[model samples]
Target: MFLDASGSAPMTNRTLEAFQAGLADGWADPTRLHTESRRARQLLDASREAFAEALGSRPEHTHLAHSPHAALERVIAGIFTARRGRDRIVASAVERDATLHAATHVAAGHVSSVPVDPRGHVDLEALARELAVPDVALAAIQHANHEIGTVQRLADVAALTVAAQVPLLVDATASIGHGPSPAHWDALVANPADWGGPAGLGIVALRPQTRWLPAWPEGDDWAPGGVLVPAVLAAAVALQERREQLDATSLRLHRMVGRVRDAAAAWPGVDVVGDPDERLPHVVTFSCLYVDGEALLTRLDREGIAVGSGSACTTSTLEPSRVLAAVGALSHGNVRLGLHPGVTDADIDRLLALMPRVISDLRAEAGAPEVA
Candidate 1:
């Protein structure tokens, strides 16, 4: 019944069990020299190694943070400032508010957002132009948009950034469990909650030999003085388990998602958004004209369905989704559905069946004529 996996996925049994085990084995201060602390350090190290192995990164390159925002904000502070003369940060317009806000806050208005096409793909030429600027410090792009599910041409943009010798920080969160990591990205941030892990855990991965510095009260960036050892192990275990089921889950989601896209498109006021073919299999978005986003959400809730409207920070705002606005899509009644492991055909069927009537009813209340 929960379709809003992007907001927070339900923790799996494997992950929950891992959490319990982690609590038992990893609940001591790892910095201490006591026997319990040594055991905790061993558990933490094992989690880091598992995370690195799954991500195709070295254990040394992985850093754990309280959240993805914490990880990316730290990255911008640590790496962006280290470059000295290069102060401008290039980011895609469709990024979730965390990166956009983080870069703007970190760079203090020096963030340049490359516009997205109406389908939500980033403007590659514009990004290349931005990267070519001598003052560009770092470039940030999402592997796939969390709202519209539009998969970016990351390899294409990564090529441009590489040639420009600008570091690329990819928020590969939306696609981490569902697809392969963009092998070319320089630094990556992922929230394990996006897969099946417990909330409040994030991963930041840096390529070896990267020029970076810890900006805050920091010792070793990778080996932070403090960490939630239980959360870390649970996150790594969840990521591994999710990746193992990705192919099967993706195939199932593709069929269900197409049904959703078709359903939304069939409604007169609802327009299916994002790239039709080159998008995430597990997510779909649509904008319903003559309806209120908040009202639609409430109606869906009444029907035993749940979905998300925008970023974690912005979904609660009355303003339209920044991502939809960037793409020139109608945002008044925007709806985004993110499928997870437990979502079923019946769940989707209920949504597809319930949506048209809801949109129709809302439009009728708004004094609009009914769809034929």
Candidate 2:
């Protein structure tokens, strides 16, 4: 079987087991006065504790949301509203779409995008310069990129923001369970799916004493509304399991990704994106000159190999990946691979053996320059 780790992996058995166990307990509003409701509240509280411990934060500080996007949006809006003073929002140019949209939605400020190096890393010096301005209210950067997998110097960025007395919101969706939580940031957001948990839940942990005003009217202390108890419990259990597997899983996936990088280097006209040595262990991206990324993705899928194309977000849109464009990486013929613990050695070998042929076919179809 081919490796399909590019955001296509299903939830692990451990997570499913946890979900089933939770299902047997019963369903009740966690805030209710009944015994079952109190039990539900206990479960939610326990889940919060588990997630908080994994992220190196206090349980009460963590906020559960319906999705990573929701968490990010809530956190950004809360920060922007609460810390309003300046009319500028500073963010890395390569931030995820949800963040970009949130920043754009707030018409009160001008958005300042910090440029990244060609290797897909934020220039800390540039960030420092921007943060130096007293008018910058909030700054956002990812702990690691989702597409190219390049890990950023979050601590350095956080320090600069702290020096500027600005709140730094980090999207750790791609890094959370694979490595240490970026506790240095003012606000942190991550998805459980990235750590082999169910897709519906996202965790946002805010620093204690961080003041946040909700963007919408709310009766509860949850970021926007009350938390999803079952999803939260499932996410916590899944995160714990993913953390337990991190050391070994990272080593194995790193080796596999290294092989992919080496193979891509040998292929003519193929350029790997991101800082190869400084990127996350489970993901890598590359571009094949002159071939269309969508076509390549289709060909791979036909051959039972599933991977991600950086060319488009949704199937309806054909725009190239903004993340790749921000770093000056090739926008065409792009492929992104994200590995998880469920992927096996055989799966990697299958993908490796099939890639060369797929590239050759794609090149022929596109009438591209020879791989020289």
Which pairs clash inside model 1? none
lDDT of candidate model 2 versus the reference: 0.81
Residues 1-372 of candidate 1: C-alpha lDDT, one tens digit per residue: 899998478989888998999899889998899999999999888888988877778888888887887887888778886799988999998887888788888788799989999898889999988987799989998889888888988789888998999999888888888877668778888888888788877788899966888777765554355778888888888888888888899889988999899877878867788998888889888888777777788888888788877522235556677888898887777788899989999888778778878988888777876655
Kindly list the per-residue Cα lDDT of model 2 for residues 1-372, writing each as its tens digit.
434453334677777877877766636777779999888888888888988888878888888888888888888888888876776889999999899888888734588899999998898888988888888768999989888989998777877888888888888898888876776888899888787777767788989877778876773354445656666777788788878878898889888889889988888888899888888888899998878777888888887777887875334677778888888888888888888887788887888788888888888987876877
- Itemize residue pairs with steric clashes in candidate 2: none
Clash number for model 1? 0
Single out the weakest 10-residue window by summed lDDT for candidate 1: 310-319
The per-residue C-alpha lDDT of model 1 at residue 165 equals 94
What TM-score do all the candidates reach, one by one? 0.95, 0.95
Model 2 scores a TM of 0.95
